[model samples]
Target: MNRLSRVSIAAFALAAGAALTGCVVAPVGPYYGEPVVTAPPPPQVEAVPVAPYPGWLWIGGYWTWQANRHVWVGGHWAAPRPGWRYVPHRWDPGPRGWREAPGRWERR
Candidate 1:
């Protein structure tokens, strides 16, 4: 009986881990913000180092908050390293309004 209980407990833990692996954690706060009337300055582009020899791509800016969740500043575009391409940040409008997606990199 004890061995059976231990097996059940292990199986339950494994199942729970597998279930959580597929679960998505929603952002803690509200998703959308009020649209701004005036557009901000063009995103600043900086020359970030490619670091290693192969070099990883540079992606566009992101909106990150300082202090609290009240404000989100935009990210900037950067020049690509030797073997990388810029992936632009895209915003999707759905029932929840704007959904900001991060940039990705693909081998050239």
Candidate 2:
């Protein structure tokens, strides 16, 4: 291969390796945020798609607070926790407002 062709091939290999490192093999815990005053609207209906891998489950989406407003985050399939169950993210009503509890995997 010419010098230019060799350089292009090397760059392509590096990009492919970087992309493969980001595979989601398991569910990750969510980040917490400040509470919002406005209550979230009803959850939107979503059609669960096929799992990327076997044993994955559809984790339904929930309302999230951003910029003091409720936003709809779409749902997706997640790799199941072998010895644990997922606690869904939710916004609980409080005296100050709605407090957001991040989703987490808990031992069964």
Candidate 3:
């Protein structure tokens, strides 16, 4: 291939790779910042069962916006990781709408 063609191909490949892997990129700030005018409150969660094993933590359920409405995702047990704590997702009202803060593990 000519020099120009090779450069174009390289640039195209880089852009494609970035686009494909875009979902894996972490948000830059506290939340995604996309908001809705309003969102329903989280559903009532069932009692948490006994931990399957020691050192497991119960992550609570939370409401997620879907199909232009709020959806409930149930809670579950998660194995505790060394030097990390699980932060649960939450919804907070914003000027434009309800901002969703996704859950993540933070270093202790």
Candidate 4:
């Protein structure tokens, strides 16, 4: 086979594999079916009281669940060990539900 034909065949194989792998979803972009927005659960209150921590900040709470398909992990408040800053949590949406992504801190 010529190089061009071989390349075309390889590309076709890759596209077929991607389809079989369930990587392609029906209609790209966020789902637009009436927006099933469930309010996120409030952050869990920290059980451990502060002794003398100054930089500790509330990371906020999150909603979590357990099942065979996927698990929902809620957000939490992170106590700054010493130098790290607290990054507030943010939300992202999907077909199943919303996801809370963890925040990061930058050094000053």
The candidate scoring highest on lDDT is 2
For model 4, the run of ten residues with the poorest summed lDDT: 63-72
Candidates, ranked, lDDT: 2, 3, 4, 1
Candidate 3 at residue 107, lDDT?
98
| Candidates in descending TM-score order | 3, 2, 1, 4
**lDDT, candidate 1, 3-76, per-residue tens:** 99999999999999998998898667533343323333345565564544443344545553223332334443
- In order, the Cα lDDT scores of the candidates are 0.53, 0.83, 0.81, 0.55
Off by over 4 Å in 1: 1-10, 21-24, 28-38, 54-56, 60-87, 90-108
lDDT of 4 by residue, 22-48 (tens): 665654433223233564555555455
Better of 3 and 4 by lDDT: 3
**How does each model score on TM-score?**
0.34, 0.65, 0.66, 0.33
Q: Residue 67, candidate 2: how far off, in angstroms? A: 2.0
How many clashes in each candidate?
Answer: 3, 0, 2, 5
Q: Candidate 2's error at 41, in angstroms?
A: 0.9
> lDDT: which is higher, 1 or 4?
4
* Model 3 Cα lDDT, one tens digit per residue, 16-88: 9998985776545333658777776846767999999998999988787777677788899998899998988
Error of 3 at 47 (Å): 1.4
